[model samples]
Target: MDEVQVGAGGATDFARWTGEFEAKVVARAAAGDPDWARGARLDPAVARSVQRFQVGESGDGANLIGKADRAGDPVYSAAVRLFIAEERNHARLLGLLLRAGGQPTLSGHWTDAVFVRLRRALGLRVELMVLMLAEVVALRYYRALRDGTTDALTTQVAGLILADEQRHVPFHCQRLRVAFAASSRPARLFAVAVWWVLMVGVTAVVAVDHGPALRQFGVRRADFGRGVFGLFAVIVPSAIPLRDPVRIA
Candidate 1:
């Protein structure tokens, strides 16, 4: 349980998130990994659920990396590279977890394929906004796996991934703040409005798509959607959101 070093002289070295991500790299290396030998057990519904998530996590991230490089911010690019690595690691961990449960990683999911294509079509700022939707949903999904499941190994894996995601939300938010720093208020508000709409649609799709596994983990579909909505509400305003992210009841 050794704490991950966040670099020396902890006086907020991660003004741009590179320091924080670096600390995560060191911590993950030092921490090694969950004991895979213990194996795992999951319901068929949950196994399928994990498979879809594994595919989502397995993206190469070259697209995002290229965009980050184009932004001309070395620090942000560095942080993004590390971020991609973490995401890759998530895929790896889930793949191994699937193996432990005697399951196989999915080749691909249509939703992810379309999602990747859409992200590639957008600028960095917009792409990250889309990506943030996934991150927000993940924060809750992983929590359900960790807290709702009785399986020890599953809990361990979910806890680890969840920890990374918790950091990811704000990291993206800070970058977004900088990305939009020069935008006029009206423009920023428009983007926020559009972003809110996307978040809502994606949340509903995920809630329905993963509903079975969520119920197995004691989460209702409505609850899942609401949880994401609450998180998105806070995130929207924090990241120059459009008019406080109205929930519309």
Candidate 2:
């Protein structure tokens, strides 16, 4: 199947995952545990960051799937759909943490709005590359949180989520490699520019928001850089070979 078809199928899968995720969030919300609520309130910065995280997942995932659907590619669509599913699970995990601490979970609308505007301005491939970079960064953050926290539940949830994020790096890089390979010289150049911009932008955001949370959690901010490098080392090298023409499945 073509990239467009794959994207469309991924969008449909995203929609399905969104519904399932919503159900889980609602159930967790109703549970109303004080420790969960306290944890939710433990770090305002972290809460805001998680809210932004959800927004990116919902808005960006929807946009990617929508574009891929228009273009018609089942493989691309399926990969993105899997992305949406994983993101939804991340949101649900955050929601569960919020509920356990006894705080209200914020909606993902803010991040979604930011993503929508960015997508219109940047185009799909650039947007996706940036999103992937952010995901890779997030995977590192979560992994650190998992390792640092002694709370059994927090550790377990973060560990599971981190494992899923490990899968995301390759999937995202695969799609990006395929897209870049299929493009002309000019398109590739444009993609490179966008990749740098995204890398810088996400790095700035992480520095401001996620950085402090790590400190509060008793982890050093420098660890984030190391983690990002680790993720890049794994993903970028694997993607290099496919820069010319690659089958993404």
* Winner by lDDT: 1
Candidate 1, pairs of clashing residues: none
Candidate that would win on TM-score = 1
Q: Candidate 1: which stretches are off by over 4 Å?
A: 1-16, 241-249
In Å, residue 51's CA in model 2 sits off its true spot by 4.1
Please identify model 2 stretches exceeding 4 Å from their true place: 1-48, 58-60, 108-112, 120-122, 184-190, 240-249
List all candidate RMSDs to the true structure: 6.0, 7.4
Q: Over the full model, what C-alpha lDDT does candidate 1 score relative to the true structure?
A: 0.83
RMSD of 2: 7.4
In order, the Cα lDDT scores of the candidates are: 0.83, 0.58
Candidate 2 on 162-224: residue-level lDDT in tens?
Answer: 666665665555555655555565666565555556665666567666666677667666666
- Estimate the overall C-alpha local distance difference test score of candidate 2: 0.58
What are the per-model numbers of colliding residue pairs?
0, 23
Superposition error at 220 for model 1 (Å): 0.4
lDDT tens digits by residue: candidate 1, 1-249: 111111211121234578778888898899999999999998899999999999999999999999989988777788899899999999999999999999999999988988999999999988999899899889889999998888899999999999998888877776676677667779997888898899889988888899999999999999988888888877776666444432211
